[model samples]
Structure formats: C-alpha cells, structure tokens
Target: MKKAALYLLLITLFSKILGFTREIVLSHMYGASNISDAYIVSTTVPTFIFSFLGVAIATSYIPIYSTIENEKGIQSANIFTNTLVHFVILICTLLIIVAFVFTTPIVKLFASGFDKKTLSLAVLFTKISIFSIYFIGLIYVFNSYLQIKGKFVIPACIGFLFNFVIITSIILSDFFNILMLPIGYVLSYILQFLFLLPFLRKHKYKYKYSFIIDKDTSYYMKRIFYLSLPGIFGASVNEINSIVDRTIASRISVGGISALNYAINLNSFIQGLFVLTITTVMYPIISKMVVESDVDGVKKSLNKAINSITLLVIPITIGSMIFSEPLINFLFGRGAFDSKALSMTSEALFFYSIGMIGFSLRELLSRVFYAFQDTKTPMINAAIAIFMNIVLSIILSRYLEIGGLALATSISAIFCTLLLFINLRNKIGSFEIRNIIISFVKVLCASLLMGMISRFFYYALLNNINDNLCLVLSVCIGAITYLVIIYFMRIKEINIIVNVIKKKLFSSFNVL
Candidate 1:
C-alpha cells in the first residue's frame, strides 16, 4: 500500500506541476475573459458526463474485478474488462452524439446569461469538446485496469500527456486564436487515451471482442450496474453543483465563471497532490478487505488514512490561505491576466482553500462507503449538500459574487464531511473519534502558528524581494515551520512520511 501510494503520489506530483503550467498558460493567454468563460462552460458538461458516469463505472468495477480475477481467473477478468470497456464506449458515444445534436440548448442551459455571440462561441466549443466523452470513458476503464494490475505509474503519467498537450495548444492558440482551444481539448484526450494503449499491450491484457453478453457476463453487468448507479447518481449530482456554480457565475459577471474555474483548478492541484494519491491507494486495498470480510483490516486502513491525510491537508490548507494572493499573482498575474482578475481569482481561491480539509475527508470517507458497497449513503449525502449549495449559491452570489459561489461550495463540503463521518461511525464502529479529533486540533493549532510566521515573512519580504521570490520563501518557511512543529510534537504520522521518503531515496540509490 505504501509503495502504491508513493508511486502514485510521485507521478501525480509531476502531472500537477505541468497542470499548473497549463493553467498559467491559459491565464496569461485569456485571463478572466468571455473566451475563458465560454471555454470553461463548454468543457463543464463533457467533463461532468465522464466524471459522473465514468468514475462510477471505474470505481465500482474494481472490487468486483478483483473478486473475479481471484476466484475465476485472469482470463475471466480480462474478458470482463473488455466487455465493460466496449459497453462504456457505446454508451458514452451515444450520449456524446445526443449532446452534440443538442449543443446549442446545452450551452444555453450551461450558461443562460451569455450574450448571443458568446453563446454561439460556447456552442461551437461545446460541440467540439463533447466528443472527449468517449475518450474519457474509455480511458477510465483502461486506467482502472492498470491500477488493478499494480501499474500506477503509467496511469498517473498519462495525465501529464493530457496537460502537456493542453499547454502546447494554449501556446499555439496565441498565434491561431480560439479554434485551437477546443481542438486541443479534444486532441489531448485522444493522445492520452492512445498513450494508454502501449501500457495495455505491455500488461498482456488481451482484448477479446465479445458483443454478446453471456450468462456470466450478464451477471457481471447486473452486479456492476446495481453497484454503479448510486455512485453515478452521486457523482452526477456533485458535477451538477459545478454546472450550477458555473451557470450562476455566468449570471454574476463576464469573468465569474472564469474566476470560479481558476479557484477550482487551484483546489484540484492541491487535491491531486495528496488527497487523490492516498485515496487512489486506499480504495482498492479497502475494497479487497471488504470483499474478504476483514473488518479489522478495513478499520485499520480507514483510521490510518484519515490521520495521515489530516497531517498533510491541514497545513496545506492554512498555507493556501496565507499565500493565496501571492500564489495567484505569481502563477497568473501576467499578459491578459490583469490586477482585477488576480484579485478575483485570489478571493475565490481563499474560500476554496478553506474547504481543503473537507474535500480530503469527503473523498476518503466516501471511498469507505463505496468499499462497503454502500454508495447510496454518499449519494444521498451528496444530494443534500447540492441542495444547500444551490440555495446558498443563489442567496450569496447575490451579495458576494464569485467568492460566495466558492464559499457555498466550501460550506456544502463541510456539511458533507461531518454528515459522512457521523453516518460512517454508525455504519462501522467509532474510527477512534477522540484520537482523530485530538490529532486534528494539534495540527490545526500548529498550522495557525505556521501561517502567522509565513504571513509575517511574506509581508517583510514584499518590498525587498521580487513577488515570486517573496512568495517562494514565505512558503518554504511555512513548510519548514510546519515540519518543525510536527517533529517537536512527535506526531507519529511524521514517521510514516519520513520513512516513505527514505525508502524512495534508497531505492533510487540502489537503482543507480
């Protein structure tokens, strides 16, 4: 588990850095403009379709696949994957065709407040972008298979290909104009999907094309279908919140959607760093444990994950709050991105940052539900959260604009996190509630102190140093201070992190 988590984290870290570069390129090229808003709106539905359905299929398929592979054989598992992959393709392709045929109305629904010309550009972008659904769905299956096969590196690496392609496309768009944006969007998905093929081949995963669903395959489909629907609904509801946020932001101002997108992207970068890495490793392990009825093992993994994730997420959240403006200015304050854009992005980002711990906890807790084949609970909780999000977004966007949209998101997440925890304790036993709370308090206090120090240094260096330099040094001090506090407190989770780094370093030396 440690090895898988580390490998995924390293690969994810690499991709996220490039992803930052991708966002920086976009901010420089477009800033918070109508073009940016249109692009964000255009891609929202397609990405939602995949994230909604594709993640449901991919996540729900894994435990069952593990069972088949273990009980039936590798041959059976391969056939199951092949069948599911093709079926996902068919469903996604049909949906995309439908989406394509209704592109104008979809764009209208996505951002009803757009002017006629902006709406037309958005429709065009949506038409071009919707085709990515097939690729996104197909790749999700392939990527899940890779992870199941203990091939985390390739799956994570392919995201870099997607981001790099987008970055290149953004660069080219400077010369060519807006057409390159949607084209590059589609092409990135295609290239990333293609890149997965070589790894599929290397793994000797045979593609036995069987359109007919035999009784056994029928059983697999029924099981996966029953299992995936709630997940799909839950995921779709969550994505709808994004669509809702974007649509509301569209009504707020020209750059509201763009600002929201920037905030989301920043949060995603933070999430991909550790929240995603740990859960990527945790879900499969816990699912297997659930299948075997290893109650103690499931409990152990959940406890450790919550603790370790907190050890990192809390500090990062505090650091993000302290450095929000500087980070935004450093990454995006250039070219088309002006002072107003920077301020909007930073303010929205601060609210997003406040939800950092909530986001991580939500993911880890939800995965436990999925592992136990209880997707309905999370789905139901997500529904409740989304309802609040919609109500709060409408009320708050009236007053606070983009920041209110973001704050509503954060508030919903916190509610979801708390509700999931309460439900999870009733479902399974107490996940050491007292201990978890104690650790969180310690971490929170330490983070607050570190943030103070970081803020002081940031202001102290603001006039004496370059913007980026001040930001970098302040962040370094904040991180080092966090480390020192954790060490002095003798947090056991620190040992887990240190041990992983040592092993990685030694492994590199041995390879050398």
Candidate 2:
C-alpha cells in the first residue's frame, strides 16, 4: 500500500507539474479573452459528459471488478471487463449522438450570454470534443483495471500525454491561427487510450464480443448500477454547480467564464497535487478492506488518508489564498491577460482556495462511503450542496460577479463536506472525529501563522521588485515559511510522511 501510494504520488506530482505548465502555456497564448472563453465553454460540455459517464464507470467498475477477482479470479475479471467494455462502447456511441444533436442547445445553456461569434466557436469546439468522449470512457475502464491490478504508475502517467498534447496544440495554434484547441483535446484522449494498449495486451485483456451476461456478471452489474444511481445524482449536482457558475459568469462580462476557468485550473492543479493523489491511492485499498469486512483496517486507513491529505492541503490552500495575486500575476499576467484579468482571476482563486480543504475532505470522505458500497447517502448530500450552490450563485452573481460564483462553490463544498462526515460517522459506527478535529485545529492555527508571514513577505517583496521575478521569489519564501512552521509544530502526520519518504529513498538505493 505504501509503495502504491508513493508511486501514485510521484506520478501525480510529475503529471501535475506538466499540467500546470499546460495552463501557463494556455494563459500565455490565449489569455482571458473571448477565444479562451469559447474554448473553455466548448470543452465544458465534453468534460461534463465525460465526468458523468466516467464517474459512473469508475465508481462502479472497481468494486465489481474487485469482487469478481475475489470470487472467480482473473478469468472472471476479464470476462467482466469485456462485458463492461462493450456496454460502455454502446453507451458512449449514444452519448456522442446526443452531444452532436444537442450541441447548439448545450452550448447556449452553458454560455448563454456569449456573443454570436463566441457561441458559434463554442458550439464548434463542443462538437469536436464530443469525438473524444467514447475514447475517454474506454480509457477509464482501462485505468480502473490497471488500478485494481496495482499498476498505479501507468494510469497516473497517462495525464502527462494529455498535457503534452495540449501544450503542443496550443503552441501550434499560435502559428496556424486555427482552432487547434479541440484537436489537442481529441488527440490527448486518443493518446490516453492508446497508452494503455500495451499494458492491456500484456495483461491479456481481450475484447471478446459477448452479449451473454453470466449470472455473476449480472449480479455485479445490478449491484454496481444500484450503487451508482445515487452517484449519478451526486455527480450531476457537482457538475451542475460548475455549469451554473459558467452560466452566471457568462452573464456578468466578456471574460467572466475565462477568469473562472483560470482560477479553476489553478484550483485543480492544487487538488491534483494533494487531494487527488491521496484519494486515488486510498480508494482501492478501502474497497478491499470493506470487501474483506475489515472494519478496523478501514477505519485506520480512513484516518491516515484524511490526516495525510488534510495536513498537506490546508497549508497549500492557505498559501494560495494568501499569495493568489502574485501567483496569478506571475503565471498569467502577460500577453492577452492583463493586470485587470489577473486581478479578477486572483480574486476568484482566493475564494476558491477557501474551499480547498473542504474539497479535499469531500474526496476522502465520499470514498469512505463508496468503499462501504453506499453511494446514495453522499448523493443526497451532494444534491443539497448543489442546490445551495445554484441559489448562492444566482444571488451572488448579481452582486459579486465571477468572484461570487467561486464563493458559491466554496460555500457549497463546505456544506457537502460537513454532511458527508456526519453521514459517514453514522454508517461507520464511529470515526476519528476528535483526532481529526484536534489535528485540523493545530494545522489551521499553523496555517494562519504561515498565512500572516506569507502576506508580510509578499507585500514586502512587492515593494522591492514588482515583476515576475519578485512574484516567484515571494511564492518560494511563502512555501518555505509554511513548511518550516509545519515542521516545527511537530505535526504527527509529518513524521509519518518523513518515514515513508526515507523508506522509499533507501529502498530505491538498495534497488540501484
């Protein structure tokens, strides 16, 4: 488990760095302009479709696949995989048809206030992106298989291909003056799917066409669908909140969607770094424990996962919130994105950062229920949270513009996290509630101190040199200060992390 976690973390870290570079390139090439907004809007529909289907498959696939592995061994798992692949292919085909038919309506729904040109561009982009939906869906199944087989590195490395494709496309677009954005997106998914082919071949995962679903396969599918129903609602809630933000932001100003997208990209970067790494590594472990009825193990793993994620996420969130302006200016204050764009994006980033811890917690906690094969409860909580988000976005957009959309998301996440925890406690019988609370308080206090130090140094550096160099230096100083404070606080979780790092280093050296 430690090895898997470390491998996934390393790959996620590398991928996230590349992903961040992709964002920087996009910002440099397009800035927060109508073109960028159009591209964002166009990508949004495909992403939404992908997430809905991807979430369904990912949430259902692992547990069922794991169950098959336990019951009938590798052969059964392969059979299940073949069935699922065929099913997914059919579903994806239908989805593509739907996307093609409703592209204009969907584009208008998401980007309602866009000008004719931007709307047309967005519709075109959406249509292009729809081509990748099936490919991405197939990739999800392959990834789930790899993950269950404990080959974390390959699955995590897939994102690097995505970033490379996007960055290359963005660069080419500069010279070609073409809408290479969707082409980049389609290529990335294709490559993402292609990357797994060798592994699938090595594993001997054949794609046999069999409409015959065995009893066991049927049973598992029923279970998965039943478990996944609530997740559909839950996932829909989350996606709808995002769509609402875009809709509201579309109404606000020309660059509103782009500004929110920039901020969200940064948020996702941080999340990919900390939250995603841990959750991805933890979920299968949690699933196995639940399958084995190892309640104690499940509790232990959950506690460790939560603590591990929170300790890292809290500080990063605080730092981002503190130095959002400098970070935004440094990465995106050039080319078409000017000081005004930076200011707006930074504000959205700051507000989004406030929900970072909640978002991270939500990922960890939601997976706990998933491990227990209970997706409905989280779905219900997600529904309430989504409702809150829509209401808050509508009310706040009138007053706060794009920033309010971000704030609404943060507020909704907070509500969702709280509800998930409460429900999880009831389901699990008990949790490390007191310990989590105490650890969170300690981390929060330390983060507040770090935030103050970061703010002081950031402003002081601004006075000295207000260029990108100073911005970079400010981030370095802030990060160092935050880590130093966290270390001195003797956070117990830090010790666990250090021990793991030492073990991995020594183990690698021995291998060498």
Among the numbered candidates, top TM-score falls to 1
lDDT per prediction? 0.86, 0.82
Winning model by lDDT: 1
User: Compared with the true structure, what per-residue lDDT tens digits does model 1 show for residues 308-344?
Assistant: 8999889889887878888888888898998888888
Note the clash tally of each candidate: 0, 0
Q: Which window of 10 residues has the lowest lDDT sum in candidate 1? A: 206-215
lDDT of 2 by residue, 1-512 (tens): 76677777788888988988888888888888888888888777876887866786687678777777887888887888877887788888999999899999989899899999898888988889889888888888888888787778888999999999999998998999547888998999999998888887773544343667666577777776788778777655657788989888888888888899889888988888778878887888888888888988988888888887778888788888877887888778777888778888999998999898888788778877877778888888988898899999888877887888999999999889998888888888787788878888888887788778767776777767756777667667767776787777777888777787899899999999
Off by over 4 Å in 2: 204-216, 500-512
Estimate the TM-score of every prediction. 0.95, 0.95
Clashes of 1: 0
